[model samples]
Target: MSDLPRLSSSRVPTPFIAFAVLAILSLALAGCDGQAQEEAKPERPVLTIKVHYAPQTPDRSFVGTIRPRIETDVGFRVPGKVAKRLVEVGQVVDVGQPLALLDDADLKLQAEQADAELRAANGVLAQAQAAENRAAELRRKGWSTDAQMDQAKAAAAEARGRVIRAERSVELTKNNLSYATLRADARGVVMATAAEPGQVVASGQGVVRIARVAEKEAVVAVPETLVARAQGGEAHVSLWSEPGKTYAAKLREFAPVADAATRTYLAKFSIPAADDAVKLGMTATLTLAEPASERVARVPLSAVFNQGHGPSVFVADAATGKVELRPVTVKSYETRDAVIADGVKDGENIVALGVHKLDTAQKVRVVSSLSF
Candidate 1:
């Protein structure tokens, strides 16, 4: 013991040290294997939807304005400076009611001139008739030549024709004078005024826009895609002022062509039961329910996944519990859902959320809607 090195209490045996190192290395290796296995595991369960196809009767809504069945621009029949405007925008007018007045000074002068001419013609006719009677008496007495009597008779006839022409002129002038006062052709409401007092307007130029209130209609711009639908669909109108009430409507008129700027068709729906509450120019909502033309399924927007390969969704197999990426043809997108036209059949399960994180042909557990 004195010659050899003494064993220290803190010193460990070589065999024991080797065994401890081996045990620690084995434990570390085992931990790494477990972590790798965990990382390689399949994804958790995903929310899904079981699609059901049915007749697709989409409802299309459009913002429109309440209008009249007959709206026309009314103007004076005679050209003149506007002396006064009797009706304003939004004024209710009856048939024959004066809407505006033109300056009648020239018209009055014309009427007076016509009347004077007619009076002069009458005087000339009276003088010619007396002369013709005298010539006939003289001829009958053999004191006047036949030529003189014939000339007198011709003069009388000419005077009578002149009088007739003058009378017609007088009537025409009177009509023109009356035309200077623009009158309403029908009972309507004034929508707009184009001519003001003292403004010169040509004959037939619009002075006021009148809308007949006997029948009501809704004028709306429909999307080109929905033009056919609007023509044959059922329509309902709701006024912005009276939201609680809705009136049934029928398609009255639809434009054959689309507007140049908006590429939309102009459509008018007639409301037979409209009342006073449905005033002209009021805001209205027109909803058209299209007939079912095809079979389709509605799915959530989140279910659709697009990765530069158009649109696709993950569908889970019922037997294998595995998901397969399926390409879907989306017909249209709604507020919170999408209408699928093709590429998937009825009774197929589709992943709803977290679509971007999934891979094709992966296994997933199906979760209920409440748990999700």
Candidate 2:
């Protein structure tokens, strides 16, 4: 006992040891085999969807801004330094309301000069009339030669022409003086102010922006593909604040060319019955709900499986419990779905998910049905 090494097991025969090791290995392998068989036995479970009939609604919705049917830039008719801004931005103005004033010291001086010229012309004309009358009287009395009478007549005619010119000059000077005061030409709300007091502006350079409140228009940008439909389709406008109320709108105008950066066409729609709540610059939703361009089916994006054999979906046979990869014509791809224009009619079952691992001969147990 003192010289021998200790042992954990009793000394056994070689044949008995080999037999025990074999039996343990066989049991371990059998357990693994049983697990693998269990894992591979059941049919693959998949999610599917049954196609159903639905009346399509073609909606082309765009976010747009509410604008006025008539908006114009108001400016001075004559160039001058602005003396005073008579009205501020956001002020409601009526027709002929003075908006701003230009420095009119020079204009007044011009008017006075024109008046003086008119007076001088009138004096000369009066003198010429007196001379022409005397010359005619003398000719009638045979006391003046025809040559002298003709000369007097020519002088009177020239004086009369100068008077006419002076009168026109006076009228023009008066008009220029009145133009110094910029006035509103229509009833509107001032939206913007460009010129301030003491600023010089050229003739017809806008100093204020006014929007006429007679009618409201919804202005939106349409993509190139929907340009024609937006121009022809029935449009409805609703404010972001007031989602429940919608106003009927008609297409008033559309840009012939697309924007260079966005490739969108600007469109304007007239709202005939817009109330006071439809304010300028308010955000609105412009929906172009045209009749269904063509009846078609739309399915979830996951249902499509394109694996080098073109785009297809695994269509399931409910009676046979098997699936087949059927080709489909995809019209368009949306954010969450694809529009199917030519394939997969109503009342057909198709695999909605897990199409990557499915084969035509393999049977799939339907776990759930999804709605598109």
Highest lDDT scorer = 1
Task: Report the number of the highest-TM-score candidate.
Answer: 2
Q: What is the lDDT of candidate 2?
A: 0.88
- Report how far off residue 286 is in candidate 1 (Å): 2.0
Give per-residue CA lDDT, model 2, range 45-101, as digits (tens): 888888764435667689999999898998988999999998887888999999999
Worst 10-residue lDDT window for candidate 1 reads 363-372
Q: Would you list the C-alpha lDDT of every candidate in the order shown?
A: 0.90, 0.88
Model 1 misplaced stretches (Cα beyond 4 Å): 1-58, 137-146, 290-372
Tell how far residue 1 is off in model 2, in angstroms.
96
Relative to the true structure, candidate 1 has a C-alpha RMSD (angstroms) of 14.5
